[model samples]
Target: MKTNNNGKKSFVQRSLDWIEKVGNKLPHPVVIFIILSIITILVSEWVYRAGVSVEFFDAKANETTTINAISLFNSEGLYYIFQSAVSNFTGFAPMGTVLVTMLGVGVAEWSGLIGSALTKLILKVPNSLLTMVIVFAGIISNIASDAGYVVVVPLGAIMFAGARRHPIAGLAAAFAGVSGGFSANLMFGPTDALLSGITNVALNSSGNPYEVSINGNWYFLIVSTFVLTIVGTLITEKVVEPHLGAYHGDFNEHEASELSLKEEKGLKNAGIALLLSLVVAFLLMNPWFGPFQTIDPETGQKTLQPFMNSGLLFMVFLLFAVPGYVFGKTTGKIKDSNDFVESMIEAMRSMAGFIVMAFFASQLIAYFSHSNLGIILASKGADFLQNQNISGIPLILAFIIFSAFINLFIGSASAKWAILAPIFVPMFIAINLSPEMTQMAYRVADSSTNIISPLMNYFAMILVFMQRYDKKSGIGTLISTMLPYSIAFLIFWSVLLIIWYALNIPLGPGAPVQVSMIQPLIGLM
Candidate 1:
């Protein structure tokens, strides 16, 4: 019995060590993107010289068109490269969303509103449901962009410590939800818009243009949110927390205190401010008298189209900014205009690393698109799958596994989707599947691997958080801690998707699992 236990422990340690060593050996994410861009250019030139091309079935135009690779080494390519560099960085989808949203979030964090509120809320919850609440909060934090990583993840560790549980277990559970369950949110967020936009681009490129709603995967994601919460809770309570054993380290039990008079007042004032903002948003988004309402030209019916299209970001900005500003004033955190400006500046400062990464990522995406490599590969890959006659569940499972594997290398969700959607969306559509379903599958796969992937943008940050408790914590420690959640999520989430497919459920509003096949149309090469 002792030998068996020792053998199991040794095997687990060896596996974690291997993962950490390989992950640490990889180049920095920015360097990887730069190298990928250069390789794409070289590959494009080679493929162009070799006259390698593929014909895609265009259902709309009723004819097949050949797509050939374009080399980026030519004069025109050089001109495009030089001309589009600045625009690429500025126009990167995640860049604007993260920056704009953080302006509001920075104010909240700087004012101490977020921390106080989180402490109060978590402290009041029953211990039995504490893990579930933390996981749920982490999942929902996506609606506010990346604030969860900086706030909820650390808070989870602190809260768990206060509760006398292992901090690392709490950290793992929170990280599982924040990064691994990123796509499973109760509400549509900037991620939905970002990925949907890319999916639309892919659909259009495939000669089967269609508009995808922000709620493209609403039903599935809503269900996924609960599933992840339950799975995360069970894993933490049964597997992770128990494995960590008791807390022998020093942790401040008094870290989470009951709300003080000033803090309570600030929260009340902030709540009022938030309520008022919501009221105004409701009025503005109302179809009856709201200026933001629109009348469809064809239907001659009033609709909240304008608000639905752009109001989410504006609402998020206001939801955080108004409450934060109110709390700051109430708590004397904001003394003057200078303080407010400084808060926003600090927020932007925190995102400097992401911005740097986005610059390289944007260039890589642009190069790949210009070179037509993604489309070509997607086409060939789709053709190969078709040749094998692997349609339906097996194909989707294969794609999910492939995507999970890819996540180990690429960290950015939007960046990966931007590249894959062009190929997969069209290919799936050709096989009588909806783009929405394909996007959902990608989300499932992308999220399932995020906890284990060191390439994730927040992985290093999470390691730093963990090391606060375990001084010896490193890449291996974090990976070994999070590996179970990663494996469980991938297996269970993939199974859920399979079950969803079997039911032929609608993925979102007007988005079904399958689409009726139409005759192929002519496509542009």
Candidate 2:
């Protein structure tokens, strides 16, 4: 047993070493972009010829299958890539959505609005609820998209460290709730609204129309908030904390700075200013009394069609901008409008790598979607699962495992979902399984495996950050430390889902607990 344990440790160490060495040696993300594009194109051809066809429920459109390679070489295929690339770079992908939203966030981040706000927010929480506070806040931060990943995740580790506890445990707990908990937010984020929009478009293309509310997954996702928090906190305190010894790093003073009086004043003023702004904006848009009301008197529906779809981005801007400007002027970072604009532009500059990745990711998704790969795979897989007559409990568990496995190769949650959703959403919907449930399962798998995946773009950024504390810490150290959280999160979260299913709890408002009980669907068996 000792020899086997030693062998396993050695293997893990070697694997980490290889990942660090090779991961850094690779060309820029742009090169990976080109490679991924080529691979996506190849996969499209392979999947198409393999007899994959997207089955639409629309009687008029029936099912659609495009010749993957033939379409690509065709003029239309070439035109689509060129057209899409411009949009991809210009914020057509999640990056675009995130970037435009960050203009407001940039102000908040630059003016220390986020830091001060976070401090004020968490400092008030009681010790007993610290873990849940961190976890829940991390989950909710998804409303600002990557702000949860960038700001809240590291702050979780720092916050835990300040609590005189295992910092790694804090990082793990936070990472679990933030990244692992990505899909299960209580509020609809820009991505949620955006993806739902895309899903609607995809369905509409097949002659079946779906409302943008196709994002009804939020009802279920919100409940997952409590589920993940409990699981994350338990895994942190019980499993992860005991594994790491005492804090021995030189920088382990473990003190979190207190907010100053000026910062406090700024926060107070910012809140008041923001509240007033919201009231004014609402009054302006109200057809009953506001200045810019555009409601149709007959239908009572607002004629402003773009507002619902684009509202989240606007919210993001307001959420960030108000606090940012308030903090900036008070903190003396913004004496003029130029400073504010610069902050936004600077934030855009920071996303250079993400933009590059988005370029290829966008193309890959477009090609795959056009080729009908996602639909084909989802239909066939869903069909097979239905044929097996597997119990729902086991099926959910297996689905989690499959997603985790796939996550190793594909790191971007949105990108992976773009490919998977078209197929899984409809397929699951057909099986009487809610798309929300499948989305929840996919998030668990995607998030748990994120830290361990060499392909995760942020893995490199994390390695660099880890090196700041321990020069000896490499890929292996990071992965080894994080792998436990990954395993625990998957196990605990999966069990929670099972219990929820058994109890017949609503996953969300208007979301069903069971896909079907009386009559099993045709392919679902």
Candidate 3:
């Protein structure tokens, strides 16, 4: 009996250690993706009913195109799987957008402008205000792609350590801001543009006439930025820091303060240069006779209703290009123009891995769409869900829960939106609820789960990082660390949205919280 009891205690201790250490340390994102992929494939079939057709068009012509009656996976036999996979991976993937955006974004990062500017600016704030600023910076860093992961996270850890707080707490706080605040930002970005384009596609397919502008979700996102900052700071100070105890780890103070006076000066000059560049770009883009202007002269009618939409990609290019060159020149990082080109080249090279992953992911999505599986499932699922008779606050609450759960498996906000938009957007539109509300709800769900989902590519990287700090942290450690923010954000953000919806606030320019369903407004091509 004594021996058994001893053994039982030993086993229990091991189990607890595993849960606290090894299990939590295990890479989460890849594991989650594999599991979700399996489930998605298992629960869904490629085939739908015969004679069903979805109309679309080929890119080559103005003529109409149609997605025919049956699943290619079934009708075309075994070989179709490979073909479908190739099509999915190669065509209509979000990878290109990521690549194109990164090309411009990477230049800013590689040139040291992003890091230098953030460090100098953030460090100048009083220590009391610095933490919040750092968190806010992390949230805004999403616009620069990898800058948050590469610069902010480590910089944050170091910043907290300098102030004699637990470094891991700082790291966690920064990571939370960067990933947790992914969906909310002050500025419109490439992701916004891409997602909006896809949203328009989904809406137009359902016979809606007007274009859904990129800034459609901007109003709510602006509010979310403040909410994320407050929540992030509160979580860091209250939950994460206390849980982390004190900083006992080995840290080099000098390493944390490596920025030289030259770099600081360079950063200031770069800022001025960036401002000048923006001025030039605005002057060029906005001029009635400038080559950059898209409007027609004869009619005096504007070609681009949302100027931001037409100039977004170019704005991205200028955002990076001028800052990068200015920083490189002032800091002697670029001795000449050749150096600037080389910096851009190196930035593109870094995305090789992302491009590869995107290839596979794209294939999966494309093939799924090509198979007509998404439409079939969407139509059936929406039909059933619409008939469920859930309404008002309860239905909205249910929508939140549903979106949150789905978010755990699918990490890409836009990709998940693309899939869910077709289903939920139409359903909400069919009812009295608006697509803007549904989209906003989806964004809330998508952002909240990012911290917890192991399927998030970065989630695994974060686990590896935690293990470096404490060999015993694992899935539970990560989840537990972030769970507070997740819960708080969900409740508070949802309440905020509910209030917004009830007040009938416009989500963006002309984007109503609710649309009249009794007499649907139709637009002609």
Candidate 4:
């Protein structure tokens, strides 16, 4: 972090510059994953020979489960390593979501649908407020999973480029909100449901016999959405945008030019198609007799709802693809069926780099999982905190930092929580802290570092997005740019939680910071 001759940059600035420089010098992303896979294999063998293992309460099954490290260096492990290669790539969650969603997004971008909309949007939106809006949109997009990373992040760059500002700055703003603000939303979505179900199990395992409701952390998350949006906007407009300076990339450079009659007609037609698509999607998800609708059977209520499953994925495809095709046809960007198909092909071509990276990334992630490294490490880390004998705000801060640190290696929130929850949830309850508060701390920590974690599910996808704006941009460039937002969010989010607790506010409806306040509803059982 050396200062330049003028020394105008602060230490933080110099540090970020150093990080970017050092990070980009590392191996190419694909090669990095390959190296990581090798490292994982060797580490697993070492831990296995050392007889390392972890045993924690398996809250779901109501028993203790032991996890022993299985060496990828072993014969059986090697077989699994070779056997699941193709399936690993295909099973990577973001792979199909990106490819399928892009089928329409590709058409939208190339067909001038997305471009025209962005142009008009840029002209209408005050430049000062653009960052806030993009950040807000990213936070809100969480309610519809996976859409933000693929759709919103790129569009942020396009809009900023069209506004004659730095494109990467806009992309950072969106990425910060989408990934870093992941757990914060105005409405409780599937993440809430999944985490609460685990929380309930953990609570019951602690002998509380309570029902940790899905809305347990609702109040905090709602406030967090606005807090993060503001924090992201500030980081983008003040820090990231200024640091990046100006955009010299090969942007379209379209002015605030009036739309041609053909463009206007295309927009109108596209709007109709979009509206119709939504109408049909609604009908298909209607609870009465919808084909995709299914009762949980256990709860006797709709469980696998459209937004709750892959139904939303297909809906995203139709939403963009139908409108893009109609717009392309109306504007002569698409001449016929072949032209429509070609748009999709062209989109796939742009994704070539991402697709290749996904292959090695998939193997690396799978190997790490198969080795039992993530769960064991998460357990050991939680055990450390539990033995510390600390309490109150200091203990809270330690837990938040621990959760954030663990999140770097283990990207999946649920996976990490499944191990940590059974430990922390009960431990916190023993100290008079509610399970909801513990869950809130975990969620805050989980999200704060996602933008900077290479192991994050969509990190490679975002790298591909970055390269579109800066061909030479590498992992270092991405991390350096995003580091500011991560730091700001971690600080702001944790402070907000602390202040809320100090004010004696409930985390959610009937979910207090004190365990004693929570009624053990399951005593009825």
**Evaluated with TM-score, which candidate comes out highest?**
4
Worst 10 residues of 4 by lDDT: 516-525
Report the C-alpha displacement of residue 300, candidate 2, in angstroms.
7.5
The TM-score obtained by model 2 is: 0.67
Clashes of each: 10, 5, 12, 0
Best by lDDT: 4
Quantify all predictions' global Cα lDDT against the true fold.
0.76, 0.61, 0.64, 0.87
Query: Rank order by lDDT, top first?
Result: 4, 1, 3, 2
Residue-level lDDT tens digits of model 1 in 168-287: 888888989898899998887778877887777666666675767879899899999999999999988866775566766886642567888888999999999999998998788776
Tell me the TM-score of model 1: 0.72
lDDT of 2: 0.61
User: Candidate 2 lDDT, tens digit per residue, 132-187?
Assistant: 87878777776655556555665676667666555655665676676667766767
Per-candidate TM-score against the hidden true structure? 0.72, 0.67, 0.64, 0.95
Candidate 4 lDDT by residue in tens digits, 183-231: 9999998889888988887777766776788899999999999999999
Per-residue lDDT of model 3, residues 1-525, tens digit only: 012344453443343334446545554433543454444443334234345654432212223445454443354633565655666555532344444555666667677776665555545656677679778988898775545654567567756766566767777778888888887899867667667766666666556664567788889889988988998898788666766656666655412345788787887887898889878876766656645656657447654434443345556666777777777888888888777778768866765544554444444444444455544443344445646888876777777876776666555576556655655665677667777787788778777777887555566445545654565656677777777677777888888889999899998888888886633533211
Q: Point out where model 2 deviates above 4 Å.
A: 1-28, 46-83, 118-131, 142-175, 183-223, 234-255, 281-308, 399-487, 503-525
Pick by lDDT: 2 or 4, better one: 4
